[model samples]
Target chain A: MKKIVIITGVLTLTILVGYFFQHKNQRKLTLVEKSDFLQAFATEIGQLWRNADLEGDQLCKKALNVDDSYYQCHPDYFKCLIDKNLIDFRMKKKKVSLKISSSYKSIQRPTHIEYLFPLKVNGLYDLKLRLKDSCREVFLPQRYYPFLANQRDVTIEWDNFNKKVFVDRNLSRVWEVRQWATKVKNNIVLKKLKELPASDIAINLEIVEMQKYCSYQGKHILSAKVYDAMSLHPEDISSPEVKLFRAPYFPWSRKNTKTNIFKIQKKQDITLTEKQSENLCKRVYAKNCTSVPFQSYSSLSSTWMGARETLGGVMEYVTNTVHPKENIILSSKYYPWSSHVHRVGIRGYWDGEGRSMNNFDFGKYPIQVFPNSLDIGFRCMRFK
Target chain B: MIQVLLILFTFISCNQESWETSLQYDLSSINKVNFAKNYLNKGDLKNPPNTWLKLATFERVNKKKCLFYKTPYREKKGVLKIVESLAGKCSAFSKGRVYNDNFSAFRINYVSSTHAEKSNILEAIYSTGKEQLALDIPLINITSPKKYERYDNQLDFSLVPDVSFGEESNQLLLENGKVCHGVNSECQEVVGYKCDKCQNGVVEVVDYNCPQGGSKYCGPNKCGKKNQIACPRGYKILNTKLNSLCFEGSPAGFCEPGLRTYCNEKNILICL
Candidate 1:
């Protein structure tokens, strides 16, 4: 009975083991079958990728499919490529680059990078720019004349700029774009000063006199004197009749070249302080000294040979500089106002008078003159 | 102990007599299946004097046994069950091909015994019904033709090869019908005929196959790039220039201008 029991047990165990192993083998075979299917699919996908010539939609599809099939193995690489390619394709349109530079270092700082903008079919466009420069207010001592003459050039260039503009990180910068078309249409008048004739050497001088001054109807006044040439003596001259009779000239002493007539005119009296005198001259000649607009009498001499000819009119001279030709002078009635001026001899006649006179239609002022000027006595300050 | 042995001997003799009596009645029954059953274990019998008894039961059912009666006799039930089994065997055997090997020897033994018994029982039970005979019952035989002989007789074996499932179906039917019975008309004309085998009592019924035609299989032949691989009949292929100038009848049916191409089936530019 024990033998029977043992024999039965062994048979049962054998059957059970066979059953278990058979199922295990079956499972392994099933896995192998599935792997075969997957392997074939992978091969086909790889072949498609290899055969695909251009890297475009077809390639993208094939690649995506390949990666999808085997994402577990190469997720990062394919993901990055797909993302980068997508971005690249999205922005594949042509773009135009612009850089900007200034004509001079003093006019503008250097820009190191270029900017790009989308291109359009019609290239005609209005560009706007707002840039920062240490010398925003350019004292082109040269541009000053025509600037004062109220004249401007076409195609004024902004410097330190190319077709491109780069923002500086080191400085407190504020740059902007503006419509050059509209901005250029309007004139930019920086500052104004007197423009002296380039031919006659001008000397800013001071004069003092205590002679007997006379008046006409108390509304006009002048220094009473008459003199003969070849001698230099103030009181040796004869006295003119009307006592003052508007001094030497009436209304305006413009283009009055009487120095050859009277040697006693070597010295004249100045009537206003330097500050008051500059203001007076500015008021009188503000329009004539500008190149932009509202200009008055202009001398070709002021704009000759790229030289800066600055002129200051004062009733009193603060410095001991003398004038060579006080050929024309300006004096106002009932007021201590005098403007040392020159009258342009056009057709041999004084067309206008005072520092505000100009031969606008007559004289051709060279384009090279610079009309930069200072108070010569005031303090100069530089901004931070 | 002696008395006990005598009693045991007598008991054995009586049991043997009873077993013999049961076997004799089973062999003499009108149902052949009962006879088959009796014969299954008859190899143990010691007698050889049963020629007349065997002659009385030559694979037939007795007319007198045709009467309907219910009884709890094991042999009678066994005989009926065995008869149905035999009928199955007969059908299987009837369809056997000549060159086939391994003819299911075990099944043959089982079926032959059951079939003989079933025929006998059926004759005994339905002997009262009038006999019906088919006037033109078909008889057919098929053999392989010589290797050198052309197989042109096979309708589907053509140059282009009836590349269609339906056409193949029709050809198979024609070949089968010609081999087993015979066809009355051209296979193509009668190819669509399908007899309802599920409802019909006849074992073998007329069957033809459907024909092959239409774009269901062979699609439009002239497909070009960006064109529909298939189109409705009478319509031709059309190629469209995309980008600024759109092409008509692309797979998507319309094209648009852009850096994009191949809008897929919808025929629109795909934005990245």
Candidate 2:
């Protein structure tokens, strides 16, 4: 009886132990299979964005549009997901539950829709807004005007420095016979013929007498001598030097014959002296016309109201003087032959082949100018 | 006599129990042994033995805990066993003979007590004593460009997924073919999917066929053809080399013949 009881107890204990291990192994295998299924599901979810035809659906289209605010909780969007078989949805009473089921045993895991469909709507909206902002045209004020029009217009009166009594009524049509006589080379014979009664001959001889002292053979006649001869003999009008101090003609110049000289001379021949420009500005515009300050000449538009030529205009005299004998002058425009002494009317103002506002040498060397220098002109500034 | 027989039978059954049940109640012991197995599998030791072994935990001696384990051998005497000390030396204990047919396939000299709790005993055992076996799949998390949030232009648009695992000792899986692991993983296969635009001409549509392409829907802008209009939104001029006028952000260009075209991330156009 004792042996049988011992055997029975031993057999039952062995069976129990064997069953426990078998059950444990089976549970472990099931856990491993469940883990593998979850892993596979996770991998599929990761690739679902690229694989699923979310673009084809109507609900997804509205949600993805950056302009539309439909991405935030649309019932149709969840319904679309259900229709596509991507997720399983349950609605009990007012509560909604979303689950993602795996292929193994239809085991489902509760899922957040946000993680599954992370639409980049906000990012797209931001990108669109930035792109629109980038395309906007920003207005920059016109910092520099290359060519500004003249502000005000005024008539200039001629300074008949050489006062002469002429028998010809047409002062406007009077040919500058004195300029021609000075160029004749043999003026000694013409001086002898001055006492004759012929009016043409007397006019020629008188003009010759005024210019003969002003001429120098192969030497530059300083503008001071011309000014001195005219200022000393203001009534002597036959001195051809009257053209040297004349106001320049602009396209907008008044066509009045009495105030302007409608002569057939080169446009460059029409110029004003430094002193003449200042005096004319004061007399004609009735304002203190000072030369643009040497320091502020380049940026004259900031303070002064006037148009300046950018490429080709007359050079103007400034008030700043480098030496007792030399004064500063500014040429706002570019001149191709700026270095030519005859054309510039001043020596050493420009030194290169072409002088532009950008490449112009400022105050490299001071310029020597008489009060009535003929090559440069000046504009009158009326203070605002 | 019957009571004596019952007590003796109980003692014998307990002593003859399997290793699985022996360590089942002691989870810490099971974890320690599993950690040692992982440490050995990670190539910390050279020529590690492959045979199964049984674990035996020793009481704390001299303020140090130790684990002793031995594999079955054909010889009865002089069976070698490994003693792993926790935070101390295991050389003080005298070697003893322990004969067990069922044993765990793991061996280690030392295992820190702190690391024992972190090891997944189930995963270690599931790998079934195989060398270089992948234990757990890494959990993926998308950290940037939060859902419904705009991407900053200042930061690069990174498509790389972040992967994380609980065990620090587990080796990271290599990405090849369909499965991508981390930032360094590359997808060699190109998807042939094309995206279409809506009738409004502004919004991009991912569908191949526009569902709203009826009279109400204006067709997509015709681009990449000679004398055609500029490319629509989300489509960039592909033949930029041939058409120098086509530049980034500039909506001018006609695609030249036999040149490739490309669409932005939205896949609004097909590159042909």
**Highest TM-score: which candidate?**
2
The sequence of per-residue lDDT tens digits that candidate 1 reaches over residues A1-384 is 888867766675566556444333122222112222222222332332223322443434332112122221122222333333421211125332222222211111111111111111113322211111211111111010000011111111111100011111010101111111122231121111123321112122111110000000000011000000000111212331111211221112222343321121233543444654333343333222232221111221121111111122211111100111211122111111122232111001112221222411112321123223211111011100
Q: Give TM-scores of chain A for all candidates.
A: 0.15, 0.18
Per-residue alpha-carbon lDDT of candidate 1 for residues B55-165, written as tens digits (9 for 90 to 100): 121222222111111111222210111111232232222321111121111011111121212211111211112442111100000011111111111111111111110
Candidate 2 overall Cα lDDT vs. reference? 0.25
- Lowest summed lDDT over 10 consecutive residues: which window, candidate 1 chain A? A210-219
Docking class of predicted structure 2: incorrect
Q: How accurate locally is residue A40 in candidate 1, as Cα lDDT from 0 to 100?
A: 28
Cα error, candidate 1, residue B152 (Å): 99
Stretches off by above 4 angstroms in model 1 are A1-107, A110-121, A124-303, A312-384, B1-272
Each candidate's lDDT (Cα)?
A: 0.19, 0.25
For each candidate, what is chain B's TM-score?
A: 0.16, 0.25
